[model samples]
Target: MKAPYIFNIQKFSVHDGPGIRTTIFFKGCPIRCLWCHNPESQKYNQEVMLTSEGEEEIVGQHYTIEQIVKKVQSDQIFYDQSGGGVTFSGGEVMTQPIDYIVELASRIKRLGISLMIDTCGVAPVENYQKILPYADGFLYDLKFINSQDHFKYVGKDNSLVKDNLKFISDNGGAIYLRLILLKGINDSMDTMEKTVEWLKENNIKISEIDLLPYHDFGRDKYNRLGRKCTQNFEVPDEQHVLNIKYYLQQEGYNVKIGG
Candidate 1:
């Protein structure tokens, strides 16, 4: 199998999963969101990005399962203490070759460390099937409850997203549902209502609901990468974000302000 290009192996990452984990960021994504923070990671190949000092820095590198496993093992003590482990994130890590992910995840779990898969949910369900056994949990993003809005901003049909999520849930995979709150975009009481209704209609069991307020941290990165940045998005109000949390909480869902 071809080795995957990982842009970064983020260590001590507390938000990606339960414990302090080394979140392996794979390079390449199929869908482009209007508010993507890591715009430089949208490509599959090793590429260049202009640094703060105006230098060209390569963005990706090849890594084998052994290399990543070793890196995760270095933090084994921390994982043992904090219940954190390894998270496979990406330019949609699920879009990478299935065999490679399966092997990588299998090897990582052999160390008795937990494994989390952060996905945009735009991939073949076969890929999820291949890795489900090894993945301890999934950080599944619910960008929009409606398919129309999903394609309007994300530029991809959300059918596959819902299908893959349903597949995982039916298979009894633990899931942490992540909701991206954009002020004038998807943050609304009506949207949240549809979200709850859909989850019930589909019988999708989510372990937790995480309300993520949109931030412009990646706007400069887009400029650095020489790409057009969408400037119309706004962060949801702090009180509104809390309101969303409370709303979901009222629906009998365990909701948190952030991931």
Candidate 2:
């Protein structure tokens, strides 16, 4: 009878995984990445935001597992048709109690719906292992392979991220490594090369490397919250993104932008 605290649920989402999905955005995160697109999700507690309709709305709503499953199962026909399923996203879904994720995912899988998790991999190794079985695919975020650099930009070390990725790879699961290419940050040639080398060395064979060019999509959210905009947020140009794509391609890796 456990109910999770969820911030939002987006239906007909295509970018999260292999098919059209209903993405459940959970309400918490452990790290404070400066370039966060979903600032509302960063806080472990609920926060209110003003909608364009000029109404105040809280970020999270409590939902029982049965209730959410009912909503998701309503789209079972679409899930079957589009090869889509339920995707548990977040500030970081694993940040929630592991039992909740496991229970929800187990139910989703039982109904033959593909389950996915979009995570930054900052949680404990045991946490990652807990949900790995129920997920059909994972959009794994690899912000910075270099631990120090990771802590500086992402406000946490990269050890857990790396370790969880290695564990996922070892378990023969479907994992997509997402790299956010921020200008003057981790977008340098050395960082990219080193990251590529590190992944290969760890025996992690990602089917595709999604090079996400940094942008200021979250700036307005910060403004809405009356918070200061993150200074020096850099979005790389087309040439820069293309160059990184080519570099990874040359390394025999399939590369795409903004996956």
Task: Give the C-alpha miss distance for residue 247 in model 2, angstroms.
Answer: 2.0
Candidate 2, clashing residue pairs? none
Over 4 Å off, model 2: none
Candidate 1 TM-score to native: 0.98
Candidate 1 error regions (>4 Å):
none
Put down candidate 1 lDDT per residue, 1-259, tens digits, no spaces: 9888999999999999897999999999999888898987789988888998999999999987888888889999998899899999989999987788899899888889999999999999989999999999999998988899999998987999999999999999999999999997789899889889999999999999888999888678887888888745888999999988888999999888877
Question: How would you encode candidate 2's per-residue C-alpha lDDT over 1-259 as one tens digit per residue?
Answer: 5555788898998888867889999988999888888888888777878776667777788888888999999988988998899999998998898887899899999999999889999888887788888888789999987899889988889988988899988987788889988888788889988998898888997877888888777677776766776645778889988998999999988888887
RMSD of 2: 1.6
Alpha-carbon RMSD of each model? 0.9, 1.6
